[model samples]
Target: MAQLSWAAPSAQALLAASDAVRNPDQSFGLINNLIEYRDGKQIDSSTLAVYARADRKTGQFRNLIRFVAPQRDAGKLLLKNGNDLWFFDPSSKASVRITPQQRLLGQAANGDVMTVNLAGDYDASIGAEEEIQDGERQKRASYRLDLTAKNNEVTYHRIEYWLDRNNSRPIKAKFYSNSDRLLKTAYYRHFQTSLGQERPTETVIIDGLDPKWITVMRLSDWAYREVPESWFQRDYLPRFNPEQAQ
Candidate 1:
């Protein structure tokens, strides 16, 4: 008997697989903790609860990020519907348009927290396969992927992503601006079983211009929940009930 020969997976397949390793397929919620550091000293931190669901028509995730900690910021929400993003404050009861490029913390951008489907929004091409250092500083053999945004609404104009060749797990990524300037570098690590997949639980992001500026994002308490379509609308921001988020 002879073994069957097959061709390698396409770049798109690899990208989609990588996305699967990072995102859940169904409606879900998770706790996101952002810890900002500078020169190895902790400077700031934020806790957020993120509820997300993919749109049936576009396959893009609609996210409602609610601030959970830091009393001054609680009850605030950041809504990401398709390409539009808005910041809503309960105190003022006002919705203000915001851009993804805006920095949320030291090294974390507003776009970074939004639930996004990379494969659904970008064009991908295969790059070199090489040995690289992962988040844990361990040597890993990885495949490089070059991605360009399909539209202007995306967070980054371009991205260079590295995935574990053997498992298609995302190891690291470099984000770029429209002018091709490197904006940030993120390393995905601490994978754990969440909502049926081995998803990355922590992300270490380093500032493009300053190595000392670092933001560590940790995600936890993953669960499949009911995310209603009304939650994605700006008009429902004021009416959103926290108990329903549970």
Candidate 2:
């Protein structure tokens, strides 16, 4: 039998191509328009801005965020330095340093229920193409995907992801706990290009167990600029950055 010279692109290849196509609109990355969370009987909403970079060698990430809400005068800042996490809330005028266990809880609250479900980690073979609504209008190609964490001990065991096929930006996601119970669902809305890449302008997280527990976040005025590395240090939260509060 003669070997076929051409085969359909691997799922990874197809996904990479999709990402490349959308990269121009998403080059500078994303600014979320909204993020909402509800836990039990409590509901909270915030406006958020996120920046992420993945380190190849360590397979880890540097994720940073500044979050604000109407009830508070100043927002909170969170930095995830690999496994360690640091947080500062201006309203309380306090900084909370998290241990690894606390970091896990924080990650869960932030919708990073599983390591694989974290944004910016891409795998092509897991999803199928579909059509989805873009913002309040416009229909676009999207990929509905299923992903499992490489490690099994995590709280969330499985995740269903919806990615904009044109840009490789995830539009929605559903997370499930180890017992196969629904934990939460996130919706990404209002995508726009900042710094040349397609990114979500808003994100909403709804707690499945408690409808009252919800969080809303919005991102605005996203700019690609260099921030000092020292900003991520726990020691820098209250002492080194007094000027930020002012």
Candidate 3:
């Protein structure tokens, strides 16, 4: 049998660049705050605590998110297993299937908060070399990338991504649907050294058609965590307890 590869040689280059810009470890924890704005007015906000573990060899990721703010939503849990994600409501005590593209708090998607490795979810290819403005409005050479989803589970069906030529860190990305309709644009900025690696700690998203609709995601509390293997199992979600795990 021939060995199967996820991306072509050209695509692999783009994937390498993406991997360099994100979490490169098997397990980690972070706190994410999602804020939404419309017409320059703040609309909504939410905070979540997330724990994620990835199988580096297989590129399989497992994530667990617990809502930490807005007392009403506190204690709600979301668990990701391979391509399937489930949401658990503490009050209802039910686990319902959910999609990554579904809005989480505002413009942030469930996948955005969970932070999956894009290299594993999409096949990427270098598109064009363009001079683009960075988050700071400084001009820089960037690699424009075309990313196609390998499976249906990804948050977006396609993405036009950009990376800095010098650092290989993600600069900006445009997410699209299967039909190629642009949905949103994201700017990765506020790079800082965290968990021993330099990575973007904030992402600003704007609606494709409505520039006034904006969302900002701020990531903090970066730490290496040892997630229990059993926490990744769907059967264990109902009884999972963060307090006892600590």
Give me the runs in candidate 1 sitting further than 4 Å from their true place: 1-7
TM for candidate 3 is 0.92
Model 3 root-mean-square deviation = 5.2
After superposition, the stretches of candidate 2 with alpha carbons farther than 4 Å from their true spots are 1-44, 47-56, 66-76, 88-108, 111-124, 131-141, 152-155, 210-214, 242-246
What would the TM-score be for candidate 1 when compared with the true structure?
0.96
Q: What is the lDDT of candidate 3?
A: 0.82
- lDDT against the true structure, per candidate, is 0.91, 0.53, 0.82
Q: Which of the two candidates, 1 or 3, achieves a greater lDDT against the reference?
A: 1
Judge candidate 3 at residue 222 and give its lDDT: 85
Cα lDDT tens digits, model 2, 143-184, are 666666545433346777766655566677787776778877
Rate residue 238 of model 1 by lDDT: 91
Expressed as tens digits, the lDDT of each residue in 1-246 for candidate 3 is 123244423655766666756775768888988899999999889989888888766776689888888788988899998888999987877899999989886677888787677888888877777779877778877778788899887899999888876778889999998889998999989989988789899999999889899999999988888988888777787788869444
Residue 193 alpha-carbon offset, candidate 2, angstroms: 2.1
lDDT of 2 at 166: 52
